[model samples]
Target: MDTMRERFVSTTSQLLDEDARLALVLAEISKDGFSAARRRHPDRVINVGIREQLLIGAGGGIALTGLRPIMHTFASFLVERPFEQVKLDFGHQGTGGVLVSAGASYDWPAGGFTHMAPGDVALLDTLDGWSVQVPGHPDEAEALLRQSAARDDRVYIRLSLQTNARAHASDGKPGFRTLREGRGGVVIAVGPMLDHVLAATEGLDVTVLYATTVRPFDSAALRAAAGVQNAADVVIVEPYLAGTSTAAASEALTDVPHRVLGLGVSRRELRRYGRMDEHLTAHGLDPRGLRARMARFLPGTPR
Candidate 1:
């Protein structure tokens, strides 16, 4: 019986470039679906055997060898445990490797504190030249992963364990699309939260920046969008803490008024949730909350 993971592997194999070697590096640790995914991408996947430091370190080596390494690890292990390795081996050297970190927040209840990663954004934000891509769904995830693999910069791809809540329109727009084009406020979103931003556009005249490449953002597009917003109306949203987009936006648009709507466990409480969807909705990070917040800046739009 074929499964989603199987289909994902099948699709990936077809989409990958013939000469490109894409390796999936599992965390020093593993997840529920890790083994199955490895089995699917057998020849192309590399399991690092629970070594976070080695997981990233080896990626650097693979990059030097011209193979595209997608380091598949838990957010906690990748961002917290071997952060130094990531900075030294990947970030500083600017190796063209993709960090595929799953369970980026408090998604897995069984993983416990040691496995939950809530500080990755903060850690990466302090560094420069690192491109971050937070995809909203399987399609976006696949697209961004391929793009990152093709690039020669240090790329980080954050993944969520649960299915995404939104699907891109079939309107021929790339997986990453710009929703609203108003010059009022720029609402940059990643992950499933994009549904909220689009819904919130019911009556506002804000410009929505949908990113397929979280890092190496389109400077021309971002600048064009920022050129029209009010000084304080530009906002960014992510399923993790605001650190990722906030820092990126500040650097990208130094003269704009910027705010970030960070998701995941609050800085104060990390142990409170039954499911990923439930936790997101309870904290006003879901569609309703996004719509409400966006409404403030784009009052001219319809209800």
Candidate 2:
């Protein structure tokens, strides 16, 4: 894990250009282990110290000058604080830059209620010309950053503070490929818990959509994956309270059998954890826990 962190950090530390800039952002942050990234890349990483609104304004300025800026802060502050600036800067001008948001839900239990922000995705999704991607793993994170940086305009990338199980990507699998093949049902899992979907369908005929970009979705690929031939059953999973990613996919491709498996901190369990790692484990988001959830979907299988 230390070596992996170093590799990611080295990759991101070298991102002076647009393409490398985005990948480096995700890799460097992951390697930084939360606070370390801010220290490592303070120039690129403008920490407004919980001021999302000011951060957005600064981000706009950086983007306006043709310098790419990747802003990091808590999800709640990001959504509640600087929406207007985001609209005026990135949204109105269709400016090109990247925004990396952390603390995506019950990730900051120590910070109390003000820090828990589950509605961040829902709010960001409504913005136009913005690409929203909730990556499920490190590899996907790398790929999303690379892709987003290559494109122009506002790109919003979300990360859960928790570490996700590595998918088969390390074995030379393309980050955006269809991970699983199911003839009867197609289950798409986005965000950080895609490893769960891959583990859950050990034997079942399920096609897994490992999408990094949540908004400006790959509708053509999604429709192809959930073709009319296999419309009887399809399941979509996300780490948010409401299955917005899955619901959005279903709405995009109607007449497909789609079920959303939303996993997040319920109000009843808000105070049960502190770090994102603990919250992920408690919410059954860990690899082992995800295997168990898959068993419920595919009974009689060894989880």
Candidate 3:
């Protein structure tokens, strides 16, 4: 199966063909993939070289003209580097565009810390009116991307190299999907962490909730899932920063007597440049590590 990034190039190319209002701005990140599309729609498919700020600025400018722009780049450059541009160009201006990003967290370990963006989601949380989607599979990525392209909203579709073994069915709506049911607790897995989370909680009596669209966080689904039990014990496993969605989960269950444990990439940087699997194990995001941690937090859960 193709990676999410590859699927993004193909899907966005199709969008450009289907919609005249859609425009794509890139900073030489995945320029090669959109070569044919660029030839087809030279005016719409733009490559702004290595200037990250300019990439967002151009996309925002296009949005100003009433054209739906999709900005593509590495996560670090797309969100972290041009954050000011993002805040001013899109949020402050009330402009709507889709920001599609690759190189999630530590997807390319050889690229070092500069390429990783474990805090991207956390940073976006500081801003308002932004819809964030973290798709675990290429099929989900394509679906979310197409959805974002159809609307003129400030949407961020996070694409990662890590993915689940299979794609879960979605109704193209922004909410969590219940994969398993139990009264012991609820495990909410975001994006690529679903497979590992499922494995970790295999024997544990917990309801597993899969989330692709995080922002406008489906508080209702969370509430409904937790409402069955007297007390809610929630565990959020994200592919980005560990505690990125913990606060959001807490807010969703504010009235209910509950506890939340956030799991994902650690703040402590791993100095060595290793494989992605190595990084996953180091961050305690692998199945073995997750099981150990989840077992400790969940009462009566055998390790």
| Top candidate when judged by lDDT against the true structure | 3
True lDDT of residue 153, candidate 2: 67
User: Candidate 1, 121: how far from true, in Å?
Assistant: 3.0
Indicate which candidate wins on TM-score: 3
TM-score of every model?
0.77, 0.74, 0.99
Candidates 1 and 3 compared by lDDT, better number = 3
**Tens digits of per-residue lDDT for model 2, 1-303:** 322223334434445432434422232224334455446555565444445576778777777777666665556766556778877888887677777666677766888877777777777767777777776666656666556555676777676654456644433222345887766556666666676666656676667777666677677777787674645354556676555665666676676655545444444546655677777677666657766765565434465
Rank by lDDT (best first): 3, 1, 2
Clashes of each: 9, 6, 0
For TM-score, candidate 2 versus 3, the one ahead is: 3
lDDT against true structure, model 2: 0.61
Model 3 residue pairs with clashes = none
lDDT of 1 by residue, 254-288 (tens): 76665544333456554654676766776567767
Winner on TM-score between 1 and 3 is 3
RMSD of each: 4.3, 5.1, 0.7
Stretches of model 2 off by over 4 angstroms after superposition? 2-12, 17-50, 167-176, 228-230, 255-269, 274-278, 281-303
What would the TM-score be for candidate 3 when compared with the true structure?
A: 0.99
